[model samples]
Target: MQASRTLSRSGVAVATARPVLQFLAIMLIALVAGSTFGIWRGYDPGGYSALTFLETLQGAVGGLNVTLPLMGAGALVMTGILAVMARRDRPVAVAYAFAFVLMAVAAVITRFANQPINADVVTWTPDSMPANWTAIRDVWWHWHVVRTMLSMLGLAVLVLAIMADRNRSSAPSA
Candidate 1:
């Protein structure tokens, strides 16, 4: 009976830990991918290279196209599965649960907010895009910034929940 109880408790820990880890993994992956493109294509006011800029832009678009969907789907499915398993009374579990939902929101923003801007950019010519483009770019940029920040914040919450779960697991039972 004691062994069975211990096993069941460990099972709970495993179920909770799996989703949190998956969330962190996806967030970290997105962060790395985003940072990579940012480093390669980041704005420098004094430096200008049309060729290099175009190449870096291509890399950025491609990176987003691949990583965002994969991470989004994995997070969504894992979160839904874990949500059903997590107890409502556990605050830490709830935080981790919400992280997955935040990721889904981020994905939608990327598709709706960012992709349209990217499409416009791709269709633009240097001469043609300048007309009223700044205002359009600003709105899209703001949304992108918000989505990225929210995703990072959600990932942080998931990390905290995982750490709390770990600490709880390590404590001596009464």
Candidate 2:
């Protein structure tokens, strides 16, 4: 009876934990991919002509068409899980909520500060690149870094939350 009960509890814990793990894994992958591109573009700002830049941007956006929805869905499911966990574990819930908030801020920064610049860049032609093209690229890189940092911070918070959950689960009950 005791062994069976322990097994049951372990199963429940795994079930609760899987979604959080999935969310963190997906976010980390996205972070790695985004950072790679951002760093490359940052160092080689003039490496691409306007047409090449636009092509690269289109390809990147096409890639995001797949990743962004997956990340967003993972985030939403994780948030829902945290919301349910809130009833039993307020601190853990709050930690997860903070993680969610950070991610939300990142998304907002991407939409408002990054997308407009992307739109402008996409419209540019090699023959008619903007006079202030450097400024636009600089601003885009700045916001991309900001959003990337926010996402990484969120991932860190989520990892902390998972650690807390593990500690709480392992501790003996009074």
TM-score of each: 0.67, 0.71
Residue-wise C-alpha lDDT for candidate 1, range 47-113, written one tens digit per residue: 4344443444455666666676676666566555555555653875686677766766777887888
- Model 1 ranges off by over 4 Å: 1-59, 127-130
What total of clashing residue pairs does each candidate reach?
Answer: 0, 0
lDDT for model 2, please.
0.67
**lDDT (0-100) at residue 84 of candidate 1?**
53
The Cα local distance difference test for each model comes to: 0.62, 0.67
Lowest lDDT block of 10, candidate 1: 44-53
List model 2 lDDT by residue over 1-174, tens digit each.
999999999989966786666466446535643653565556455566666666776666656634663575576556556646654778887887787787777777777887788767766667778887777877877877787787777767767876776677678999
Best by TM-score: 2
Q: What is the C-alpha local distance difference test score of candidate 1?
A: 0.62
Residue 94, model 1, lDDT:
83
